[model samples]
Target: MGVLTGKTALVTGASRGIGRGVAERLGRDGPRIAVHYGSDKTAAKETVAAIEAAGGSAFAIGVRLGMPGDADRLWEEFDRHADGLDILVHNAGIGTSRPFAEIGEEEFDRLFAVNVKAPFFLTRLGAERLRDGGRVVNISSGLARAAAMPQLIAYAMTKAALDVFTRDLSKELGPRGITVNSVAPGIVDTDVNAAWLRASEEAWQEAAALAALGRVGTPADIADVVAFLVSEDGRWVTGHWLDATGGSLT
Candidate 1:
């Protein structure tokens, strides 16, 4: 049996990119995964199929975030499937690379609403259903600590806020043996960045050069780090922001 054979995990935004990778990885460990998707039901089903093909269990849950009743709606859907949660992976987020001066109020509010507010309320309500010794892993970005991309200022701010939430939540949930952490990744080659990173050879090379490892990162690279965090081996680690940045921040 896998380490998480009887556990349940909820991974938001599992329809694609890093979230998809996390969902699949955790599924491999035997957790009954709740694959949450914002609007892509087909992609979510594919994620669930992939897990099942690997001898894992998973089900899809769809709910649009950044709205008033997002968290509540998600939990209501979740209630139909499982009673308790062992892992909560907040991987759903939106990004913007517009220069600080050009960004409008509507854009900034939407960024915070989806990226920060959604996760905050999701955890607040989900925490009651999260069992003791459960895991809460927030998929943060290296920009939270590094000012490498000035154009992504607003996106960076949201991640920084998430990191703070991880730290404070860890302390608050420590007594229950729950662990909260933020995993920061740098220049991951996901659909989110494909437009720019894969647009030209020079762009790709420049992005690769940022990582000390001599290549851009992949979803699986971040997923492996997350897998370790939620496993029994990571029991003693909490309230920390892990740099899964391939030495970019170093």
Candidate 2:
């Protein structure tokens, strides 16, 4: 039996990219995964299928984030699938690279709504449903700690806010044995970054050079770190911003 054989997990934006990787990893650990998708039912189903194919249990839930009542809808759907949650992975987020000067109110609000507000409210609504010793991981970005990409300033801000939430919420939930943390990844090779990262060998190398490891990160790389954090091995680590950037910050 896996370490999480009888546990239940909810992964947001699990239809693709890093979210999918985390979901698959947790599912492999034996959790009944709730794969949450935002408008991509087919992709969500595929994620669920992949988990089940690996001899794990999973189900897909469709709920578009960034709108009013999103948290309510998400929890309502989750209630139909499982009795309680052992893990919560907030991986659903929207980002933009628009320069600071050009950022409009609508764009900024939308980013905050999806990236910061959603997870905050979702956790609040689901607190009672989360069991003791539960885990909460917020997928943050290295950009939140470094000004490497000025154009992505707004996006980075959202991540910084998430990290703060992780720290503060950890304390609030610590009494119940729940641990909260933020995992920051640098330049992961996801579909979202494929267009540019694969544009040329030079572009790829430049991105790789940012990390001391001299290689671009993959979804699985971040996934493994997340797997460790939500496992029994990570029981003592909480309320921290873990740099899963492959030494990029160094």
Model 1, position 72: C-alpha lDDT score? 99
lDDT per residue (tens digit) for residues 1-250 in model 2:
9999999999999999999999999999999999999998999999999999999999999999999999999999999989999999999999997999999999999999999999999999999999999999999999898756779989999999999999999999999999999999999999999999999999999999989999999999999999999999999999999999998999
- TM-score of each candidate? 0.99, 0.99
lDDT of each: 0.96, 0.96
Off by over 4 Å in 1: none
Candidate 1: tens digits of C-alpha lDDT, residues 5-49: 999999999999999999999999999999999999999999999
Clashes of each: 0, 0
Error of 2 at 35 (Å): 0.3
- Model 2 residue pairs with clashes: none
How large an RMSD does model 1 have? 0.7
